[model samples]
Target: MADVARLAGVSAQTVSRVSNGYAGVNEETRRAVLDAMKELDYRPNSAARALKRGEFRTIGVITFTLATTGNVRTLEAIATAAAREGYAVTLLPVALPTQDEVRGAFSRLEELAVDAVIVIMEVHLLDAVTLTLPPHVQVVVVDSDAGNHYTVVDTDQAGGTRAAVRHLLDLGHETVWHLGGPEDSFAAQRRADAWRAALAEAGRTAPPLVRGDWSAESGYRAGLQLAEAPGCGAVFVANDQMALGLLRALHERGLRVPEDVSVIGFDDIPEASSFLPPLTTVHQDFAEVGRLCVAAVLRKVRQEEPERGTTLVPTRLVLRASTAGPGRRDAE
Candidate 1:
């Protein structure tokens, strides 16, 4: 600390501000402090500082898994937003979110004495674990309602699915087939519900629901079956990765996209556009979701009154070449 302060020609308090991400330091001083720290190879002892301050100036995030593109994007956005607020983020990934695993992660965070916790476990099992957190710890849930009391931030999965199905219906398609995500996921259930409701509202026979584990391979398997089925003109996939797989499967089966099938997917990932035919999908603003979650949880931690309920982030459809008119060659 002394060496960095001497080299940067700033007080110890200024060095502390630079390390803790406390605002109010001028740009020149902040740059000089960073340069000095880099030259001296001085690493701030986060643990020691956290112990002394009773506040880590850091938050812990728990996610069910990082296997899917949506999960990964949400976590990245949360980290980026937290850093901008001068808080560090620590991610805790749970491969299989058993009761013990969730409990254990919270216990560990309790020991670290972090300011708050954000759990991204989007399954039903997480609710059991969240009920037992120590009262002092403020918790915010992502994509799942932990309970009515704690803060919850969720994407408008149902609304997005409704939009996609309605779009297909307006395009003169009689009915839309659904390629759903894992049964355990809250998002998949919401999407499936909305898809069914839209069909029911129009007095149409709801097509058989195809299930996937949010993987491209599973979507490809479902696609193979749907491609062979009669009157399967339009499909709404749960996520883009599976949509990519379905597109490939249709191509290999000598079926033409938009000509033989029109598909819509969720999560407008960057790769969606670069596909052989650009993908038509829904966009979830994960960065906004992250920012909302952080601000929500921190408000509770700071003893400020924030809206005490769930927040739904809006989604939009990005139409692309993957969807088009049903051709005259439909199997009768």
Candidate 2:
């Protein structure tokens, strides 16, 4: 520190301030210190600094799978948001949602230098045990009902599902059918429940739900059956990937989109608009969910009172070419 200070013609205090990223240092002096440090190959000890501050400025993200679109997108947003907050991310993937596997992941994170953890608990197995988790680390959860135990950030799944159903009904469809995600996924269950509830609220019969494993292949199989179901006019798919397969199945079965059956999907993925007829869908703000997760965990990281509740980011109904009234030629 003193050597760089001497070379830069600045006080050691000025060098320290520059190294710590403290503001109010004159630009010229900051440049001189940086130049001297570069020339001398001097690097500040991050571990020592973190120890002094009592925080490592890193967050650990634990998830069961990143194969689904929501998980992958949410993870991307978390990394971006963490970087904006001057923090790094460490991903810890658990092979299964079993209690032992989740606990093992947290145990591994405990040995790491992360200040907090964000678990994308898409599986219902984790939701059942969230309230009983050990308090060794501060955690913010995504896609779980852990509001009573930890901060949870999620999309407005019920609200979005209701909106999708209502939209189809308003367009003159007598009833809407659901192509839902796997039963074990928290999001899939929420959407399915909301779909049924929304139908009941409208005094319409809830059609039997076709199940998918959040995969395009499952959707293709489900779509084949739906093609044969009598009076299957409007279909609300859980995610866009599945919708893609469903669209293909409908096409191969010689059913014209909208004119024969209207389709609405969730997630509003980037490719939704490129589908042959596009796709009307619910748009989840995964980026906002990510930002909120980072903020909530950092509050605990800074020794603030931990928050225990769910925060929902709102969803929007995006109109595209896929959904329309029964027997209509296009979306309105």
Task: Tell me, by lDDT, which candidate is best.
Answer: 2
Worst 10 residues of 2 by lDDT: 125-134
Highest TM-score among the candidates is held by which one? 2
Residue 210 CA displacement from its true place in model 2, Å? 0.8
TM-score computed on alpha carbons, candidate 2: 0.91
Model 2 stretches with alpha carbons more than 4 Å out = 2-18, 21-35, 125-131, 328-332
For candidate 2, write residues 227-324 as lDDT tens digits.
98888989999998898889999999999897899999999999889998989999999999999999999998888855688899999999998877
Q: What are the RMSDs of all candidates, in order?
A: 4.4, 3.2
Q: List per-prediction Cα lDDT, in the order shown.
A: 0.85, 0.90
Reference-based TM-score of each model: 0.85, 0.91
